[model samples]
Target: MSLLQTAPTCDPDDQWCVWVSELTGNDWLAQAADWLIAKPLALLVLLIIAFVARWLLHRMIDRVTNRAAEGLPTPMLKHKPGKDVPATVLSGRRVQRAQTMGSLLKSIASIVVFTITGITALAQLGFAVGPLIASAGIVGIALGFGAQSLVTDFLSGIFMIVEDQYGVGDAVDLGEAVGTVEAVGLRVTRLRDVEGTVWYVRNGEIIRVGNQSQNWARTVVDVPVSHEQDLFRVQSVLKDVAHEVWEDEDFRSVILEEPEVWGVQDMTPDWITVRVTLKTAPLEQWGVAREMRERIKARFDHLGIELARPARVLIHRDNRAAGEDLETTGAPDGSGTPASS
Candidate 1:
């Protein structure tokens, strides 16, 4: 008779071992003692269940969030008078938040699934998890207190999500630093600057943020010229240039309203500052400004106008006593020699 037949009694001490021995009609208890071998089918089934649960939960969350967000009008895409401009529609802020929400939901679902799977597996192995959970709770509380910054980061991240201040792909000015939001998590936000440098800033530490791509960006161009240049001629030249630039296919597509020259904004003894404003598409202001600069330089060069800057034309002089005077002794017309002291 196998061990299972002999150990038919329900003894929790060696229930699985005895059952396996009885079914196999062999001393598998020795192998079980040496190594706790888990059945592949059971492990595979558990993992599959966990994976499916995670997938289903994630899909549900994404579907719900997307539907809800889509139902509500997104401010980032809508213009609000002076607060927003026609260029706001092109900003990626709203869409980026949707994607970020999806990612966060997916992460949460994965964690929930894994935690359930771990607990289920532990239960199946006949391990008592009550004390483990209690101990874990205590440890977590202690850790939370010790690592208050971590808690602050987590809380701040939650608030950030709720407020929707900025999201991935949105251009933001984090204090003095400016960058596009690449990723936002429970702890840190990743930003890619214009120079391609990535900054990882903790959410808790970010006290204030300036989101440039929130709705629309305003660009101001200042062109300074020497006071010698004619003011009316400069304004007329700028007007003609603006018209030409506006007519251009490139600027027309990016510019919403006609470019306006604000006339002579300021005048000083050395230079005059001319201001021009253009209503451009979001993020297109840079290109428009650059094109305007090129046009200004070309027009100025053609008009024989020079850019103003500080300059000096120095004339050196030297005075000496009667005994060491250049007027007393000279070597040549170009060179002067002082009299002997």
Candidate 2:
């Protein structure tokens, strides 16, 4: 009976309105029912899409993570002198790093997927998506400003792990904290110093990193001998001692290369320093240097090599002769006042 069959409150192609309008007619009731039914259906679809997308993204992430983990390099720990490179397996540090990366990616993907779904649901329910998004952006900005340091720390840690700048068992000098890394995390790096004091350092605060445990290390021992001793002779003796240390069965395992005497490193009136150096395994420099010094000392004792010693000369007047008492007013105290000797 009515030429205007389309509901004014609903879209022309809205299927929900058309389906329910067959019984209720194209009236307010149809539109009301369409809203009640259509909005929920749209929200349901969005949720399904969100879940599917999240699943796909997570699966992709897992695949990529596994690949990365399997192909991970072993730069953080050097290859042993006489051993081949170990295979990358889901164990030890490589697995730990892969797990960290995968978890972070999954979390980000979930947040993004769910957030988009929520916004779409709100828009479907007749809420202004623009203002909602703008308000969310403002709130996000506020939160970012408030938690800048936390964000920086997290980002820094991620990069540190990815780039293999440092890791557990690495002796690192991270600005104020210089020690062996005990644990690495997203926000803080734990270290234990030579004194065994544990340090929790925020990753964001580290500027430059000095990793002393990666690759190989060098041991330098400066042996000072009397300047009067022949420099060439001391250098030969130091070279011999260094070679003995490097060849010793106990020290040879830590020493990577043959030792060398680097001639004189410094010269003073009292002594000349002979620099002996050895290439050693990571973290083995200290022990190797100590051993080199001990061997050099024992060798010097056997060879009667004179070590440098501080010297000072003091002169006194030898006045025990009869003519020495002929002085009239020589001050024995050395004061300006005249006095009898």
Score each candidate by Cα lDDT: 0.71, 0.76
**Which 10 consecutive residues of model 2 have the lowest summed lDDT?**
81-90
Q: List the residue pairs that clash in candidate 1.
A: none
What is the C-alpha lDDT profile of model 2 across 1-341, one tens digit per residue?
45454436556677787777777666577778867777777888888899999999999888777766665444332222224212321134455556667787788899999988888888787789998889989998998999999999999988987766776887999889899999888899999999999999999999999998665678988887887788888888888888888788998677877888889898776677789898877788999888877888888899899777644333345567743422233232332332235
Q: Which digits, one per residue and each the tens of the lDDT, describe model 1 over residues 1-341? A: 76656643434455555666667655546336323554444566899999988888888877766654454444322212454355245334555666666677688789888988887777666679898889989999999999999999998997787578887777888885689888888999999998999999999999999876555555567888887878788888887877787799866766777778898788766678998887766667778788888998999999887876533223333655433323333222334443433
Separately for all candidates shown, the number of backbone clashes (residues 3 or more apart, or on different chains) is 0, 0
Number of clashing residue pairs, candidate 1: 0
Best by lDDT: 2
Residue 293, model 2, lDDT:
79
Compared with the true structure, the alpha-carbon lDDT of candidate 2 equals: 0.76
Q: What is the lDDT, from 0 to 100, of the residue 2 in candidate 1?
A: 64
